[model samples]
Target: MTAPDPAAAAAPSFDIRREVVAVMPHLRAFARFLTGNRERADDLVQDAVVRCLQAAHQFQPGTNFKAWMFTILRNLFYNEGRKNRVKLDPLDEMNAGAHAMPPDQQAGLEFDDFRRAFWHLNEEQREVLILVGASGMSYDEAAAICGVAVGTIKSRVSRARAQLARVMEGGGLGSRTSGNQEMPAEMAAFLAAGTPPKGR
Candidate 1:
């Protein structure tokens, strides 16, 4: 068999600007989920596009550029998330699981409920939950990103879960099995200690 020319065998180089534009719709969707504001989502997407273009060389052609760009955008949003709280309706859930309700409708309801429950949690708990549950990061990775210990992350996740349960309960979604569900005292103490003092 004849060997193909090294140059001829190579695929054409990918156009960073073109690619970024093509992914704009998807990027906007991601930004909306991240910031919950159309204007801010546009700004964030523009910023991510600029960053992606600036470091175009970092992207390998014929590979998953979209995923790479998304990762950058997601990280940037997380870095600024606390300063800009995502506005979500309590009726719209992000996780509209398998049911008769349309996915979009269900997601909105889920997002809403999640948003309400999420706010009741302290910062550490919220961050851990979002990182692990929404962003899909592992506990260790979340700890590293937050610059904290693994045990600390574990504790935060546990507390966050408990807090979510309580918040949901307070929202009238708690199971009847758990009568008068309340946030455990120990968990409350941990939360109080871990949360940064206001105006700090």
Candidate 2:
């Protein structure tokens, strides 16, 4: 009998890798939205792809590979999120609001302020908001990834927006000044503009 053809054996694997590359733009977008930065997003996507390839056997053929890959990416995000220990820099207490810089300086400070504000949100709320708002995922898809009901996702998104608003306002980075409020109105709209819908 002829020896097994190793090259032939890896052909199927090559096809799977090709499919993954084809979906990379979307995956990168999702990762960037979730992490709120390009470097972290690229790392996340790379990690997800590696994990997916390692667990290729688990994937069922003739099914939705895109969805399957997305599920893997989402799971990895949550797993790492729980382990994230990046500490946020605290504001100076002795010199509260001692900002003496120009408006240009304030602009850069405002970006850092927004980043810190996002870090303050509960993990679940942040995840829901990013998936639904920044990543362009629908409530249903985000809910599935989060393993929660549509209502739960909506609630989380709402609370996230409200919490962000409160944080910005308290930190003197209100919408009128923050320029987009960091949390876009389209994202906050999920909170029904910070109010419940009618008859609720």
The numbered model that scores best in TM-score is 2
Candidate 1: lDDT of 31?
67
Per-residue C-alpha lDDT of model 2 across residues 22-134, encoded as one tens digit per residue? 77887886665556556666888898999998999888877667667777877888788448723323333212333444545645455455655665666566677767777
- 156-187, model 1: which lDDT tens digit per residue? 88777877756755545422223444545654
Q: Candidate 1: where is the Cα deviation over 4 Å?
A: 1-34, 58-71, 78-115, 119-127, 140-152, 172-200
List clash counts for every candidate, in order: 15, 0
Candidate 1, residue 56: Cα displacement in angstroms equals 3.2
> lDDT scores for all predictions?
0.63, 0.66
Identify the leading candidate in terms of lDDT: 2
Summing lDDT over every window of 10 consecutive residues in candidate 2, give the lowest-scoring window: 87-96
Q: What's model 2's lDDT at 191?
A: 37
